[model samples]
Target: MDHNHQDPSTGLLTKEFAEGLGQFMAFASNQETTLQMGKMYCPCPICQNRRFGTVRGVWKHLYSRGFMAGYKVWYSHGETDLMVNFGSISQQNNLDEVGEQQGGVDEHIGNVQMVEDRFRVEEPKFEAQIFFDMLDAAKTPLYDGCRDGISPMSSATRMMSIKTDYNLSEDCVDAIADFVKDILPEDNLSPATYYEIHVSGLGLPYQMIDVCIDNCMIYWRRDVVRTSCRFCGKPRFQETRGKSKIPYKIMWYLPITDRLKRLYQSKHTAEAMRWHGEHESNREISHPSDAKAWKHFQSMYPSFAFERRNVYLGLSSDGFNLFGRHRRQYSLWPVIVTPYNLPPSLCMKREFLFLTILVPGPEHPKRSLDVFLQPLIYELKMLWDYGVEVYDIASKENFMMRAVLMWTINDFPAYGMLSG
Candidate 1:
């Protein structure tokens, strides 16, 4: 008479419910198919060689694993419905105790049974708006190309519709914003000045005036521009003068001085700067002679002077002919410079310089003056005497050279002409 006395540990499903679930698993399994060794095959457990022999095998597997107990089963047939609650095995002991007060084991089981009149599956329905709403709340909204199933939210078709309706996603907006912020007056100064110094100090015999403007320098010999790889040192042409030679050439602009500043001012820049400054100090001592050399060079080579207040140094080569030419032919490298700081006194006094030396042939001697060699060596000596510190240097086959330098005048006499 005590309902609580029923099996308290293994709260198995009622016999009728277990049979119904077994039938459903069997029906679902029979619908799957497979391919084996170029032949199509049926995937039903009964038709395949596997441990699970039939649809009933799968149902028993699910039951032994405890998925059937206390689960809800909803069946509907044209508005006629039935809901069966199979109390979970883990909750069985408690239910048994409660059942004693309401009725016995038979009564409790009857209360949770589903009626035969309700036994149909509902068709699946899509909810598009819900998906789109979730996408709108994302931190970074999806772009247009993303609508073609390339974005994170692409799985939700409704979200793609909303993105298309708004026309708000554009790939280049962020890049343009970055560009505008960089070209501002305050952000563009340092690289402009440094670029000018490098070009002049290198004795390149060319001018680059506008550091902030992109692609300001142009190579006169389009043919020579098409040779070798500048960064990777790969040969680009079979012969310097032959049509087979690759034109090794490139166009360069000053580093984005103001753009870099704006970049640093952004939230991301702060964290990056902190890490870089801590890990590596980019500072160096400036030399006085380098400053004088630049001044003298600028005076002598007026053609190389840029009309703009700042300049940037950069290099590029015509990829087709880069490897075929000797070092001397590619000596006229482009340089970039931009301005930094303001107030003539603080900004004008700063000096930036770079040097590039191209050695011709593998056995070229130490004193060999290949093309623009004399002016470059003279500049180096002048920079050394004035106590300028060298920052970087690089050289390679067929004559490619590059160097960087910085200069400053410390404790100028009060009456000296350098004083404001």
Candidate 2:
């Protein structure tokens, strides 16, 4: 069961490798033509199967570079995940139990599963090629003499940061990309578009719930088929030339379960999600978990609090002026939720903040704002009453994960609206 084939102290191969290599090659050879290119995936310590090699080249690597540690399952080599019991292995190496994983999920997940194949890809053509392509791009340096941290990953992400800071249009991305292209070599990206690169694993589900023109009740749940708002009796649909009835107003809603599970999908974020329980702290209020509110809630609901993985979240919303002070024609209201489970340093980060609902307006819906929150409250109730099954990459198992809205944060006037 011990898959550590190389002795870390000496950087030498263990005796077990000599006997195991034959069996390993036999398995790889059988699956190679079907799952990979002509060359088999090299399991050498240096390449770590991130590089492919000819059978002979791979054998040479195995001899010289050494075998990577804890790869007993061979999931990368087209082995079925069900073949080996990963749960048992993960239990033996839980983040709480191991000294090796102290740094966080990113560093820990690299050893377990890298980006491209982090989640399982079933198609062969999809799996074999993408595994190496993304891995290469992720590791590639933007330019020579660049620091290890300042590479393509950093370069492109910085470009993304610029776009976000300015709230630039999609049209502007091409201009920025062209400038970077003139500088660095053509990276392993599709000329088709960079949407795939920008949002690879970040695609979450959303809904376009119909809203009344007067912003009374959202046409949701049992009211979806209704032609008018229940409270105000305002028309739900607008007249059209054809038979189609377009909604007078629409509210954008993003679901939370997938977003929560996605936190556990990444190697680093998964571990960070558990920081509320694991991080060392003092009596002086550092994280929300250390505060009186969290302790008081825990005292009342010990059963819910006992499960550290059950997420607690903060929902916050505020109105932003979309136009200049001279032309204050529009405002945008975004309802964002942040997990209380991450350590103080990460839980409140902009990247960790998820926008679950978008309310558009010529004016803020001061009184009717709660009507827009109907979908979110309904979903949160479902999450609390009946937990959802989520896969934990760090633990390598499925667990019933529940979430509760710990509190709401807003400006004074906005608080009056939400509080009422």
Candidate 3:
């Protein structure tokens, strides 16, 4: 059989894979093979939704068609690649540049090399040291505007307080920016630009998913294709605050896979994550990783413990009142994903806790937790079944990462909802 050059789950293609497909398609067209345009050309048995806007369509077609169908189509048409083989998923190593077989030992070696080349992403070239160096060079002029020796961060602090804490309008930002510039003329950066620089690579950006106001279902994946809530028939976007414009609710999806990948992206964080394993301690008390439950679980499931780098996460959630001392309080639920891979001292830190899901509400879904947690459940199920491909910074190689939702920590009220 043959394999498609696309990710099975996402149908994402590399530039190299897309270009190769384009060349093969051009070759087939030259040989008088009739090619259909748009979605009509897709050979997938499950779907016919491929569009001709870009290579993404080609990726979708190849992925949906699967190995067997795509192979039959290529072989029957007598299409060939002088430098490639499609007979097997592992054929990336079977042939040399001229499509000829190498030796058995050489094939194994080549396979490993090919896997590394395909998955290994070099560390980002931008160094934090460079950023600090630039800051050091600008420090003198940054503090030059100080009359009575006010700190430079004072201006930034005031700006953040006004924008985030006070929830000021956009028009206020320009005036704040002007005031900050007057104080530090050398660093005359706008508030927006400064914010971008500060948060450029702090964490993985989140995805927004539309959710039903009734807490019945979230419009994600296949559900997203529809305009209205499947369960309640309510419009995906609802009028709120006595206005006819704003969306009623949205679920912010920050996946565990993406968050773990960001940990590997930074050299410092990658090393820091190994502190639990590397620390020298013979005393009875320290980190949660040192506890009996943690050790026993690892002993029971030795496979999970084989890779010390594999992450263990804890789930937590609670409902809180967004408005205090009000006639009608807005109830908001936030689901927090905590990485237990960090040392005990840092594991529970505010900065390390990732807000994976933010359930907006004027009222909490007390008993309807499962319905609202549909998207998270789906992601967890997929992670357990297929796992995620992640780079192992400690080893400087790629590995399949499988994270366990070790435990759930919630209040008594939330416990019943989450457990039920």
**What lDDT score belongs to each candidate, Candidate 1 first?**
0.28, 0.68, 0.58
| Model 3 bad stretches (over 4 Å) | 1-161, 178-203, 239-245, 264-268, 278-286, 325-327, 381-401
Cα lDDT for residue 370, candidate 2: 90
The parts of candidate 1 lying over 4 Å away from their true place are 1-252, 266-268, 275-328, 332-420
If both were scored by lDDT, which would come out higher, candidate 1 or candidate 3?
A: 3
Ranking by lDDT: 2, 3, 1
Best by TM-score: 2
lDDT of candidate model 3 versus the reference: 0.58
Q: Candidate 3 on 1-420: residue-level lDDT in tens? A: 234555668545545555454444433332322333211222333322211122233333443343333444442223446324544322233234212211111212334554443344434224433443444443433344555434344445566566778786656766666665666556444344345323432334577887777877877777877767787888877556775655567777777677676575456677677666556668665777878888788878755564456678889999888887787878888888887888777788997898888877887787877766777777777776677766545445445567777789987888999853
Worst 10 residues of 1 by lDDT: 391-400
Model 1, 239-350: lDDT tens digits are 5666663323222233222232232223433223222112222343142212455447445633222111112122211112234565543322322221221222322332
My TM-score estimates for the predictions, one after another, are: 0.16, 0.56, 0.55
Query: Native-vs-model 1 lDDT?
Result: 0.28
Residue 390, candidate 1: how far off, in angstroms? 28
Ranking by TM-score: 2, 3, 1
Better of 2 and 3 by lDDT: 2
Clashing pairs counted in every model: 68, 3, 0
